[model samples]
Target: MEVTSPPPSLLLSDSDLEDCYDIIDPPLTTSNDGSTVSEDIHKSMDEFDRLINLDRARRKMALLNEETEKEEEKK
Candidate 1:
């Protein structure tokens, strides 16, 4: 026996959609489990900064490599 999938409209109910949105865009909380919130925020910010710097460095390296390749092609 073969089974067919449910229609897109019937796949997710209104409540399910709201739950998905809640997961995607959660409300920010100032304080949760005591003063650890600040520490968590600081750690996350540091991680974000590190990722941004890494991405910038990667772009610079890619551009430098492209320029080097072009110079080699000219020779």
Candidate 2:
């Protein structure tokens, strides 16, 4: 698959980015209220985290591959 870097201006707004961060690193809650979090919410959050991790890893690998190819061409 071809991976292209996004333009800087295409990035999410600060507020939206913060929301994502909050979901990935939720605040510590001491309340054990039954209505705290539903099973579906937990599942969705987990799925989002997995997707984010996979995307990050793929980007990193693409960058490394680019660097490797450049080095090989220089050899």
Candidate 3:
């Protein structure tokens, strides 16, 4: 089977398609890193939407990465 990159919608802005093929982020445990990150930056949904989008993109990309890895191994 031939491997293919994930569709564009499944990608994160900070990441390249090749990056996903090479490195997948570690799974998020019930507690991720045990710390609050980038706090105090958003006071309202208007400002917070970007962060929300990024988090969603990251999760989508990670799932796609895992799927791709599994397919590659099977091949």
Candidate 4:
């Protein structure tokens, strides 16, 4: 008898992808000792900061677009 492996395409699902994302992008945590931060927690905080900056930039762009449209209307 011989053993065979399934195709790569059949091995993963949406849940698996979400689990991977959660592992890579974990929730942020703050240190209680005020001494040092864990590497995983630091990484999570960095990811969070990046997401917040991106969101702020998106909102600023939208506001700028609205302002530009208003100026166009004044012409």
- Strongest candidate by TM-score: 1
Distance from true location, Cα of 56 in model 1, Å:
0.3
Q: Tell me the alpha-carbon RMSD of every candidate.
A: 9.9, 19.6, 25.2, 10.3
Query: What's each prediction's clash count?
Result: 0, 0, 0, 0
lDDT of 3 by residue, 2-75 (tens): 99999988867755755774467542333354432223233355468978999999999999999999999999
Give the per-residue lDDT of model 1 (tens digit) for 4-65.
99888779888998999879976455665554555678989999999999999999999999
TM-score of candidate 2 to 2 decimals: 0.51
lDDT measured at residue 61 in model 4 versus the true structure, 0 to 100 = 100
For candidate 4, write residues 25-69 as lDDT tens digits. 764555664533466676789999999999999999999999999
Candidate 4 Cα lDDT to native: 0.83
Pick by TM-score: 1 or 2, better one: 1
Candidate 3 Cα errors over 4 Å, as ranges: 1-43
lDDT of each: 0.85, 0.84, 0.68, 0.83
* Model 4, runs deviating above 4 Å: 1-37
Clashing pairs in 2: none
Pairs of residues at least 3 apart in sequence or in different chains that clash in candidate 3: none
User: Which one wins by lDDT: 2 or 4?
Assistant: 2
**What is the total number of backbone clashes in candidate 4?**
0
**Predicted candidate 2 versus true structure: per-residue lDDT over 1-75, tens digit per residue:** 999999988889999989998899876554565433455578789999999999999999999999999999999
